[model samples]
Target chain A: MDDDGRDRPPVPTGRSERARTAALEAALALAVELPYPQVTMEAIAARAGVGKATLYRRWRHRGALLVDAVAHRNARAAVGDGRIPDTGDLQADLSAVLRAVVDELAVPAWDALLRALCVEALVDTAVGAQVLEEVFAPQITLFARRFAAARATGHIDGSVGDVEAFELFVAPLFHRWQLRTGALDHAYADAVVRRGCRALSP
Target chain B: MDDDGRDRPPVPTGRSERARTAALEAALALAVELPYPQVTMEAIAARAGVGKATLYRRWRHRGALLVDAVAHRNARAAVGDGRIPDTGDLQADLSAVLRAVVDELAVPAWDALLRALCVEALVDTAVGAQVLEEVFAPQITLFARRFAAARATGHIDGSVGDVEAFELFVAPLFHRWQLRTGALDHAYADAVVRRGCRALSP
Candidate 1:
């Protein structure tokens, strides 16, 4: 719903598309330049040269807008597609996907932006919910699908539930990255895949 | 080191010890009551009824003081002893330890305080380093030690390194809790232990 609650779509025009693009771009840039909490709607409007009303019409609040902004960035970067390659080799496929994650996180700008979003999500429950829904769920669901297919094909043990399988494959990287406890590299990612397979494969 | 670069211990009188206790308690309370970045030294001093000079004399900055406050709370609660019960049943012991973590995180004040500390650690590299050293390293090291012992006893596969072993046993819970991705309960904790032991045990 837009700010006015009319539930109308974004004005579909070349100009409207440009403004939306500019607004999301500005939100991403400002999020990186300032602390996430301090990146206000007004600043995003000014940076994007869009009226506050227009920005609000598109997004309900800062959280909503920033969600779109980060999602936009991720889409542009071709990350979080939620589809693992299925060459009938589960470990090799998982390793490739996790290595891609390592590569994405290694980029400094991407790291800072994600860390900022993570800080915001940690503090605010509503934002956290939105992030879980829009950002993480798609990827999680797709990964679960891949796991189910693997189980059906006898690539993994059928006893492991989807949730456990997903956590087993991915949680180690998320844990290490969040805590800054160790290096997040291809080797660690491959180790996770190897361990996960040993635990799950038939 | 103290703020003045003098390496003196806190005054060892009974009165000084009481003051120190009051300060740490105040820091913990204020950290829960306020946003972490806004919880300043002066504010902690005022809340504790200790002079600001005395607070600084014992600790270098807000991060250092807050770390002590959190560690004190954990110690009083007996949370992070870094010792897992060696009942020769690795899965049961891991389940017991992880369930304790889940219980600790279930407390509202403890959750809020640790989340606040996590936010600060995420934003500041110096604070991050200190947190890793004082708050997380001990737990990780002790867990690693337990894994090594388990390996030597032939409880777990010897091929898994300490790093992979530790991550396998602990990282899933940390991942779920940090992301608020699912229910953090005894059942989930037990599931993680089951999966981990299956992955690691000979």
Candidate 2:
């Protein structure tokens, strides 16, 4: 949350906060409706009933606006501060977390939005970096925290790094989803969990 | 390679073969130079020194053209029939394969072209499916073949399906590359091989 005063606008007052929310909501709506490249700043401004100057003042480019918009939505949609539950059993927790992930991916609107974000990320590395920082990094950190707890309980090997270890479970789901290689169902999630548990064992 | 006669143009012969090569080469060249959405069919035709009619005769759309172009480049770039080498030592072979994969991903031009293909694949599900079937599926099959050999030699567990098991090693690499999560080096690749071997043990 280091504010260099470039990427983010000044802290908004109550009235401007509402306007900011409206602008972000409009951006997200247009994002899911149109391809990311086609979703222009002008369109978002018009959709939000704001002037072009107002939009530009807050966001430098369409990619920046879209990243913030998606980040906002992700934050709102997360369940209870977005921490993966550690129920003392790492396998069950991983299965439950991955199951929820697959379920979210099954929703068309959410999938489309995520696809758009992914396209934007690929198209612009700066956007990609922002997304990693604002979205995926926090989630990865939560997983790391959960892994630490699991390690304390002697559930996983102490030698394997949590970040790398977590990818054994999560990355396959992401890779499958990105490529449209197969169905993203509970079965696939469970299989990943099983493999992950086996891999992390001492 | 079932030809429904719709997805592919008539097999080129004699002089038309040159034109087909020219078009595909141009598509690949332009794909690396420009963002995928901006690489128009007209531009490709112009660059190839071929008429629009010649281009259209082969490919119905830009996506189709790009897919073939990328697939062609991939086939040619692949070393020795594109199979994961089965030297009877599964760990060393996987390490070698993954090491080569990371090397390929590091090449700037190749990375750009693959990024373009990935963007196109995300934008169009049809393109996505074609990329999987024509490109990734063959490679997956190769991995499956290697895993089958490994299983026979007792290198891995028999209970896990080869297709699903292969993801433990490959998907993490793909995910890391796509997300730019970390440095994809020999070190990362070797780490994955270690985790993969541990995960796949009987």
Candidate 3:
């Protein structure tokens, strides 16, 4: 029906898309089911029902594959509709973002996957950089932009440093989660954003 | 030789304190030399010149042994004067603590041990809980107490939440160090305390 299209549904380019999705899903599932040290490319390929060569052709190593999977998962779940909502209330916006993070982190699969990635990153320097640059850094940038917007609107004190404010607001959540020291909840999220905003007040 | 002397050169106790020390040192050394997953108890014991049974007797598993070794190293390095140095300044106290932490964390052995422990903790729930309770929770408590003192002294607003404030000030340092994002330097430390104190001000 279309130019350069053969009959029989154009062989479904969706098949490759489905395969990639399935591979990522398999990687995440295996990460949850097995320890990070135990996860292997061969195992993921088998789990995804793709050949080993196919997976290797797509990703050079397990770290690369895993990082892509995490990035994909995060992009799918991130909030804000690509705009940091400015409700004339900085506190509300911060609270909303922080709460969304809390919800995303609450997913057991996410927790398991992050924990595995963190462990792998610690052991592998290249993977660590990739995870930070590709995954964590972007999230921080988004929050920093929102804080910058708030500053511009005069809702936040201009004296407050952007990077410091960004770290002050988000680091607590990750610290609590990574160290397993406390609960990462809506209550905690509300407190973080509230305290952070108040600190930034003129 | 003085009081409880039932000793003919103390028959080694079949658990030489020297052996334990050596094993810990070896574990830390090997962790840096080899990947964490490859640093087996057998390897540690061999490196320490002790029997595998000796290591097993003290630690239930490799994870437990590694956790203890890392915790012990942190404790030795963390010895301080136990004074929160109040120069009538909240920022001064925070600076002193942060400086001490910087000094301790600068040691290569400490960094390696911590990395190994952190990696193991991700997959091992018991080890993770132990590290949190024995290491992180205590450090957080110390900061919380100092914040509470600052609140009482009227230097900081009493209404500012202590726990959240502590995390806001300290988590970034750990995040940067553990995640290898940026240098944990004095300037950054000073900025964190200054901005964090302002943020918590009522």
Q: All models: lDDT?
A: 0.78, 0.80, 0.74
lDDT of 2 by residue, B29-77 (tens): 8877776676898999899898999888878788778878866666666
Which RMSD does model 2 reach against the true structure? 3.4
For model 1, residues A1-84, the per-residue Cα lDDT tens digits are 125311222343688787888898999888778866678999999999999999999888887787777766654554453367
Q: Which ten residues in a row have the lowest lDDT in candidate 2 chain B?
A: B1-10
Candidate 1 CA-lDDT value: 0.78
Q: List the residue pairs that clash in candidate 3.
A: A199-B199
After superposing candidate 3, which stretches have Cα over 4 Å from the reference?
A1-22, A29-39, A47-49, A159-162, B1-22, B25-39, B47-49, B78-81, B159-162
How do the residues B18-37 of candidate 1 rate in per-residue lDDT, one tens digit apiece?
78878988998887777666
The ten-residue window of minimal lDDT in model 1 chain B covers: B1-10
What are the candidates' interface root-mean-square deviations? 1.3, 1.0, 1.6
Which is the better candidate, 1 or 3, if ranked by lDDT? 1
Q: Please identify model 1 stretches exceeding 4 Å from their true place.
A: A1-18, A30-40, B1-18, B30-40, B58-60
| Models ranked on DockQ | 2, 1, 3
Off by over 4 Å in 2: A1-13, A30-39, B4-13, B30-39
